[model samples]
Target: MDLDDDILYEDDSGNESSENGDDQFMEMNMEPESSSSQKRDEVDDFQFEILTPDKIVSHMVDCIKEVNAVVEIPATTTRILLNHFRWDKEKLMERYYDGDQDKLFTEAHVISPHRSIVSKPKKTTRQTAAASSAEVTCEICFLSLPSKGLTGLECGHKFCTLCWTEYLTTKIMDEGMGQTISCAAHKCDILVDDATVMSLIRDPRVKLKYQHLITNSFVECNRLMRWCPAPDCGNAVKVAYSDAKPALCSCGHRFCFACGENWHEPVRCVWLKKWIRKCDDDSETSNWIAANTKECPKCRITIEKDGGCNHMICKNQNCKADFCWVCLGPWEPHGSSWYNCNRFDEDDAKKARDNQELSRSMLQRYLFYCNRYMNHMQSLKFEHKLYASIKVKMEEMQQHNMSWIEVQFLHKAVDVLCQCRQTLMFTYVFAFYLKKNNQSIIFEDNQKDLENSTETLSEFLERDITSELLVDIKQKVQDKYRYCESRRKVLLDHVYEGYDKDWWEYIDI
Candidate 1:
């Protein structure tokens, strides 16, 4: 099967219109949908797309910034809340609204060191938020310090600046705990967030490492997110729906957003995986001729029954025994061809017959679909060559002052051929695995119509037609393309509907 890289691709003639031959291509219902509108309706509806690592980091920073503003908390406290909520902004709101604010702070492991036990302290205007208060005890170093000696988190843990910095630096740099660090107290379990890491970690390299961890967590923890599978792609995709699906990344890599596998459509993901494993497992032993081997009756040597007559002589001369290849019995009773030996065992003939019939029917059906699918792929390659020739033809006609736009019909025809051929290839895949029922017949009829339309479009694209005929051929191609696309979508929708109804439930095994 020509099931090569199935990613939908374009040869980057960016933004070139199919109807560029003439400003007046032809009167046809060939108005292409706006790409932005299409993306908005289908892809962007999930409020996500693949983004580069830089963009992911930027998004992470923005989320932290937004939480900081709304909660009126320091960035460290905001990050603690965010991490506690698994980076879900809505869940953070839910938790914040679910109970007492103090409870929220306690659960997030944030304690305010500046809390006054007796009464609320008078508002002071002189110092910034990061400034440490004087007269604090440094618990880690057991030092009594004057003012400006210590900073504290909401969790009420306080330590001298030197101790806090060393602890943060050690956790972030040496222990690789930059993603999260707890309070400096030996027994404390309060998890410090990135904001605190930035404040306490003096080294720029450690600060950068902490930032990277916190930023990368945005994609790592979300259910509706994943890093792109392509090597060095460094992009991720997220969507509200977490179902198995193929998505086109911004980096031009098409992949399964769920498992990060290559795009495989028509076949469901589970079924495709089973098929791949089966192929791998049977790769060596599944050869038709090799599988037909038998043992020599006389010497017990393994022998392959390569196609010939039923009569056979043992290759093991030491025990030269003439045995029928079919029955593996002495040749005298089998006579010449031994046609009678080919009969199934009467004792379990019914069971054996049913299995053989089923296997034959399934194999025939698969081959029927696979051959047609491959034929379309081959035809598509030829159509691509035809388009190249059309390009050369247009170049030669440059002296006539006839722009490709005036002959845009020919170009559009080529586009239609490509689109239809691709559709036809996968349509067969969908058909073969589809459940056998009345709908199967209807689906087949639809497929047949699409195949006819595709072939008709292909003929138009390949024809050596006069310049005057370009418009008519173009119009025909456009109409056929639209029809074929409609049919293709209908078939795909049917298969997807089958999946929803549990048509392929056991396919994975």
Candidate 2:
């Protein structure tokens, strides 16, 4: 039965055509779904609002041209466009439709605008106040209303923006009052301390409103001068003419000439002496001066008078006194000559005298040591030259007398002479090395060892007996044996002792 059914289906051409048509329909439907999923993923990843109706319509036209397929616009994008234009389908289509397919394929997509995304203007309380205060008149020029404009400072003082700007720019540019731009009102020199002027000028509208004020024209008046802002004080302050520093008033008020807050104190004027003197009484002044007094060489404690000579008077409360020029001690009445006032102590005087004697002794010892060392070095050098000459003569003798026995004997003698010369060299070298190493005792001991070794060798060589001569010759040959035996003795004792005594005496001083 199954074989018969297959044979019937194969024979029917309509059945094959129907199956192929169904497969084509499925592929057509799946293509759009896959393409739309890809586009939606791309749009989701972007941060900007680039998926507007206009941009979508522009992209759709390009997609249609590139694919040459009936591209259905994304449902998300279609809904967004519909909502933006109040669901007006015809208007959305008209706005987004691309007329030329070739052009759409070449150009980039455009973004559509939404009514909800429009930017709104900013407003602040200070700006609102400034606008309302535009009706107020400037005291300097006596001008009123919107023609001159208004500038509201942080201190809440309002002025014509033109007048304030002109005054500030001129003072800063021409007169070099570049730091301050205070209010122009009489006795109201509050500063305009705004931190956003750079940003405020970025707006074209604000810049246009205050253009004249920014130029060089306005002049700062005395009205800009203010009392020091110090608490409980009512001192009037002025800007220093020579320096930019602020002058303080008697009431302790501090204001800069540029109309900024008190940055620092100004130099005291010479004319303020009388005013300062009038502030306190005689006894009060005397006490005040004493408390603030400086000790003088001619007098003792005296009040400093500004703009006067260095000469002073003693104003001690107990003794209103005078003293001599040379000495700084108290003097008898009408005494013109100097008096010796230095008190002497027994121990201190003794120490001073001892120090002087010690210094002299040290100098004498240093000179003696220096002379001794120089003479010793000269003697060593002379001895070394003499020994070297003797060595050359010994070498010549060995060369002239060629008998084997005699040569052997002369070689032995040369060896002894070489040993003696080496001893001398080692003594000098060891002395220098010990001095450098601060081991003068060891160096001196080595020198004494060399001297003893030389004396013993000389005595052994001078002995008359043949056996003694042979023993001396053998001893001279055995350098290592002699060295081992002599190693335990005080070699450089004398040199070290002398050096130690000299060094200690010099250092003690």
Candidate 3:
């Protein structure tokens, strides 16, 4: 099967479901065995609902209505308050009820209609003349216009409708602001409401862009939500709570909701972020240089002795200090010798060699883990080919008188293999930063067992199959993949256990 068209989904219960239809890949009991474990396992059933742009907008409206029902405020103002609180209704309620009402509205950049009214300021001659003539001066355009031509927020900072359109358009299109677009009046912190934006902006393209910006802001600010990181995918996953857990998007992309990277378990978001930065940086290049190159003792300028004699001289024009490449000692001290320097056995020379070797060892250690990490990453990139090959195998098995459901084991095997590879890939990342200890040794052992089984399963799947040996191959493939799956779970369980027991220790990069 083309796995792209039939993407697999795993719910909180660990039962697998394919999006193409009701065909389940696997089913297993998820009930906790004891009451003590029930609480922990309950989190396994954590629910989330995937939302489209329209649904997200509807949800935002519902939230505004819900809060408005209790607070009895205008729906427009409620939206601003909800956004200010990052759509956290409970926290908004707590602050609204337990704190100063005027202060809350002030912070949210809105004038509270419920606030006590103050004495009105005396009108200027121009204001009186405008009031009498039913015309007002627009501060932005400096043009006198009819009172109906101007608009303003509750803060009473008014501007012409044309100026409002230009200002809102500039903010929405240029600055990419939606929910936080403040008033056009100078020094005015009052926000422009969605109703005002819709009423003023008539262009459909700008309106759609505004709506998109609003939806983006809603999802980005909400703690329980995240936009699927897949390219061109507009779906957002809204969860019951925030966590560093794996989330599969409707577009068939699986990623960690916390940091929006590929679903990397065993390793964490912080370490993965650090590792990515390390990989992107020239830190390893510097390490290689430190390990392979020698610096001049007199001027501390780095030099790489690619060839020639040991009587090395500093390349610096001002500080041409002569030194021996073998011991890095003064050339005068090795006058009787060419390649040999007696200072090679000296304390300073030994320390210098030891430091270089230490750097070399550190680089080698990083490469040991990095190479494996990169190998699995490259393998993962070509997993689609594996899936296509398995589809062919399934067809071959069916031609040998096997039923459709009977050949699903091939798909299951490939699924398990991919899962193992993914987990194994991140295990190397986890191991890279892990401090050596008994627990880490055990973790490494588990990693090795899983890796060996995964490679064996991969080999079995990639081997050519004949109709004569289909029966025997089917049994072996199933058994090997099952073993791989179990091993993967075992490794993950041990890592989770290490986390729970505080058995894992980490080293700073």
Candidate 4:
């Protein structure tokens, strides 16, 4: 019988049967027979078809080629393709044949061996190709750079370190980035991050160059500069050279040691002093002899001695009249010359009498101003007392749990009264200064009129029972009080705003 067909004939003790039955009988002889023996014998006797190694290899090769042909596959997918080719080749050979199949498997697993190979030479070639593709050149400095050396900002523009650092340093020095530092590139708003700077400065030599540009070439103040030490003076003090001692502030005021102004004893350097005298007239003289040189006390004009013995002549056109060198009086020849007389003594006496009269007139004016200032202060004290009384009453009313609307109305009233009182007080203070100094009385009289008007309006509001009347009174008081306040601010501004620089220098604390 055919191997694919069932067996037909069998013999056992003259009995006829199929070969399958005979085979089963023979299998029963090989082991302990069991109830499942019939099923086991049928299974052992069956024939089935199996795929050969060549056919499996061919299928795997076709699958790999199809996957590789697809464009833009991800790296993971590409890795899967390589792994499948390797795994299927080994699996096929294990199941069908156990001999070496290196050449057959190699041909099936890889396509274009030069391109798909993962050897060292192939990897090196790929890296070289990537480097060449990514190389860029700086636009500003026109320097060629390797792809890795280039840095891209948020704007997506790449720049070399040298050009970017120079640009940033200029911007920081000139237009200080007080709150924010934005990109220097035109129309680009990217803010520079600190990491970008650190990354670009990998080369030590390039980093040193960048630092020099930042510290030296930039116009920013050096660390040695300090704020002025004068109390309430917000000016900055800077010196050109750190090693050189700075000159003192001309106002004769001292500052902290770090403020670049320190007092030191003046040293006598002959040549230097002479040169300074030519350049600056205020240079202090060297010795007692130099100090005694005749200089006009009023104008400090130097008088040269010429054509006279033991006497100086005043050649100044304004003071050409004769004067004594000792006393600066009208020059009277000491030796009983033609000009010697007691008439000089009589002239001096008359001048002293005139000075006494002038002093009396000045005293009278000062006393009158002082009395006016005292009267103004008294009026202010009266207004202050009235305001304090009203404030206390308002506070008491608030603590009694009044309606919010009523409380708010009372608060507004109290606020208006307090503000009116402040305006009056400030005006009084300003008037007091003007009066005490015997200066112009116009400002004082004007302030006094405003005070009276404000006080009357405030009193009217307090006495008025109707809310409408009180509102009207409040509006009037605010208008009048605000006018006075504005005037006071103007006056104070004039007095304090443009103070002399020397005035600030004298602040001790």
Best by lDDT: 3
* Better structure of 1 and 4 per TM-score: 1
Q: What is the per-residue lDDT of model 1 for residues 1-509, given as tens digits with 9 covering 90 to 100?
A: 11011111111212333332211111111233223421222432444565555556545556666675666655556656787787889888877767577788777777743345787566556554334444556777878886466777655677778888888877767887754577777777778654455445545455556555665666777777788777877677867678766677777666767666665556656555555564457533533323355667678787776677777788776987887665566777655547676542443434434544555555565557767867987987888788788776566555455676765655666776776677667666556556667666766787787778777767655666555655565567668767766766776677677667755423112
Count of clashing residue pairs in every prediction:
15, 12, 0, 0
Off by over 4 Å in 4: 1-353, 392-468, 498-509
Whichever of 2 and 4 has more TM-score, that candidate is 4
Deviation of model 2 at 261, angstroms: 70
Instruction: Write down the lDDT of every candidate, Cα atoms only.
Output: 0.61, 0.38, 0.79, 0.40
What lDDT, from 0 to 1, does candidate 2 have? 0.38
User: Regarding TM-score, does 3 or 4 come out ahead?
Assistant: 3
After the best TM-score superposition of candidate 1, give how far the Cα of residue 148 lies from its true spot, in angstroms.
21
TM-score top scorer: 3
- Which candidate order results from sorting by TM-score in descending order? 3, 1, 4, 2
Q: Give per-model TM-scores.
A: 0.55, 0.20, 0.84, 0.24
Kindly list the per-residue Cα lDDT of model 3 for residues 298-335, writing each as its tens digit. Answer: 99999998787888888799999987887877888776
Poorly placed runs, candidate 1 (over 4 Å)? 1-39, 43-50, 64-221, 226-235, 243-267, 272-291, 294-303, 307-339, 342-368, 374-411, 464-469, 486-509
**Candidate 2 local lDDT, residue 358:** 57
Q: Model 1 scores what on Cα lDDT?
A: 0.61
Q: Scored by Cα lDDT, where does model 4 land?
A: 0.40
Q: Give the TM-score of candidate 4.
A: 0.24
